[model samples]
Target: MKTEQLINALVADIGPRRSFLRSFVYATASGVAFDAVVFFAAIGPRPDIAAAAETWRFLFKFVVTLALAVPATTLAYRLAAPAMWRRCRFEVLMVPLCLLLAATAFELDLVPPSLWMVRLVGSNSVNCMTLIPVLALAPLTCFLILLRSGASCDPGLTGAVAGLAAGAIAATFYALNCFDDSPLFVITWYPIAMSTTAAGGYYGGRRFLTW
Candidate 1:
């Protein structure tokens, strides 16, 4: 076909449905993954909440979560590897932003981190930094699912995805850490994280759409 005809066809094919679906999926996955991961990380080990005097179950579970989260996230990344790899600039900025946010949040007492992990250094900034590295799991999961389904990023929808992804991931992590104890963390940090994710996702989406 001619160039103008081809352009019109392409526009009609992917115009809004793709964008809407992409946003919807990304948001849904963010929420779902966050909830599941948090549940497993915080409550998987503790059967009898009342009987256990020590909250050491979290210690065990935290290690398990990290071990599990890393591989899980890695696999997800690999699945979405093409899109992720394509956004090298996002990845580059993402690392430092993750570090800054995590540290700032913890130094501000955003969430109580793994006990041993927190106490070992005693810097009060360690938890955030440590935690931030793994925060991308939700986004990667969402991204992977999108890529696998052959859905492309929607222009003007990325912020929403990023926000939902970030929020969902934060909620999951906070829920785990706060399981039965950290309500303050849940109430405070979950929203903060989600908002951050939304903002980032939207901005990132804007960038992705442009290229």
Candidate 2:
């Protein structure tokens, strides 16, 4: 083919870029709404939600999960682009992690050292581990769909961040129903559940996100 013809063909293939961040936000919102409906229908908030809301411990769970979700989502959108910014998006993830760690440390100092293990174990370790990922299913699927709309440099990483966002949002939903408000419990099990979904996203992205 002539050089001019090749240039014109390539130009024809180029199209206006879609906004990954906006698409992801819409997808995440849809997933959250779906989860909310399911939650209210089958798994309403804890019976003592009114009372629990008054406590800082109860509020802390939402705050931490939200904090994690925001930055992680931002990073996910960034990863969708071809040229990555040099900024350390991963470092932003540490802010919430360190906050939870600090809260856990404070709680340990205040409570009986002997009961530390009990707090860590909490009452619903099994449930938290199971439900967070279960609840994350819809959101993770939505995030993956959104991720596919973009030209991500690393599909696996993009998917993993999407999983993290899904898990964080799911955990936030679960916290309303969970009776265990201890920082120790939040610090431990939340990450495990998020990690499970993140791994799933990574593999799914690798298998399906290629052009």
User: How well is each residue in 88-170 modelled by candidate 1, as lDDT tens digits?
Assistant: 23343244234434544554474455553443333322333334324644553455335334333453343344445444444
lDDT of 2 at 65: 95
Which digits, one per residue and each the tens of the lDDT, describe model 2 over residues 36-64?
A: 98888888899999999999999999989
**Candidate 2: clashing pairs of residues:** none
Candidate 1 — which pairs collide? 158-201, 158-202, 159-201, 159-202, 162-197, 162-198, 162-201, 163-197, 163-198, 167-194
Best model per TM-score: 2
Candidate 2 Cα errors over 4 Å, as ranges: 1-19, 84-88
For each candidate, the alpha-carbon lDDT, in order, equals 0.43, 0.86
TM-score of 2: 0.89
Q: Model 2: which ten-residue window has the lowest total lDDT?
A: 12-21
